[model samples]
Target: MENIWEVSPLHRQVKSEGEMTDLYKIEIRDLARAFCGALFLALPLHYTMEMWARARAIPSFMLVVILVAAYLLNVGYCYYSNFKGRPARQVPWLDALESLGVGIVASTITLLLIDQVNAHMSFDVIMSCIALESVPTSFGASLAKSQLSAGNKEDDLTDGWATDKKKILACLLGGLMFAFNVGATAEPIVIATSINYGQLIGIVVFSLLVSYLMVFMTAFEKEKEDEGAVMGPQWAETLICYSVSLLASAALLFMFGYLTPTTPHNLAIPWVVVLGYATTLGGSAGRLII
Candidate 1:
């Protein structure tokens, strides 16, 4: 016969209540971190007019794509780079989903607090804006383990020569973060510089060169001991990383309205290259720290 105390309705009820309480506490802590992280990285775009306009103009289908991309990025960061202690392969899907939700919720709350969202705005406008902003916010939330945790070391000794895909994804996330922080301010600077065709070409060359040096030749602490052991030829790895940063730059330029479908190919190419300069630095820095 089972023990009366173990099988008792009152005891089971008490155990269930205790479990629920602990779960609530964990959730509350996660919420606090998510809000703080999201706000830290997202504050600039929260107030920018370009972001608001893009939010309205972005189609619903693209918005869904953004959310899905953000989710995958966050999951990759959370699972591979940030939560190193936990076996990411075994991590439940729900936790990743919750972090994504946290990003959206935190962005919504911050926008509301800043008076960006109000009853005066159409529901579609508000939702679209929140979804657009959530990309960076969610990425930041995904990085909470690295950014928000106490005494979290930036370098991981166990991070051997990571697979090319992981390294590229890290570069993309870092570049995106850097771009989100500066893309809004870049338009004015780009316009003011009046960068001519020659200068634009030079900028592209310079960005690629700098990106290569930063990753391979810099005096910065080594990220991987077997850095020279990448699967492909050295130039191939460099090109892959450079391409990721360039792609990130283009995406950010589009999101910030610096590039549009109507823009001529020749004109748009330079701006993307120029922005890639800053974004590559960010990507390299991200690889170092993350």
Candidate 2:
């Protein structure tokens, strides 16, 4: 009697070695393509594509650039992880930088466009988002690392090449998704009296939700709901992250004409926008330094 050649959920038919190899190849190819496509499709509505259209570089051309760059970045990042002997929760160069770098780069380009055309926001707006970029991006990245590391298959623990690449891809996708959603939803409004309390509330809520979902989906989606995590950065270290923003906000309000320079405000531009970003992202980078 012979065994049946039926396909399993993982796609390899439960049969010969050649068939399994073939199936794995196809899966990797498809996954790469899927990742590339999602990378473009998920770019936040505010920047990149919106401005790319302005560049008139042709969409297909940009696609080529993204595919090539992403493939190389993926491969290179994976190589380092191989020597590091740790899960991607702590791969310093790519995971955190990949997202944080994109956020800052995107913000610069977007604000430049706004200044030339709209000129609606003050210097503080860009600074604030840049600062916030640190926190929100790091927070988002950390969430992904913690959540994903907790849920990964034990077999893949030392399989550095495959595991790290997937983790990096997840972080990139997470950042891209965050940008796209925020771009579509972000008000980017200028405040006259003080920061919009409502807007801050919304940012807080949205950042939490976005970070949670992305971390859950890209990295830790497979983990049990009640499982506790031992990987990723420690929670205590994040105080520096918050502190950077607090001090920055305090300074900005005093110096930048953001606050009355006399009466105390609940949130300062430095805190929310600049220091906030530094602390949030800064501390994460500190952890990444290891």
How many residue pairs clash per model?
0, 13
lDDT of 1: 0.68
RMSD (Å) per prediction: 6.4, 13.7
Show the lowest summed lDDT stretch of 10 residues, model 2: 180-189
Position 3, candidate 1: lDDT: 35
Model 2 TM-score is 0.30
Off by over 4 Å in 2: 1-19, 23-28, 31-151, 155-186, 189-235, 241-290
Model 1 — TM-score against the truth?
Answer: 0.78
Give Cα distance to truth, residue 150, candidate 2, Å.
Answer: 13
Pairs with steric clashes in candidate 1: none
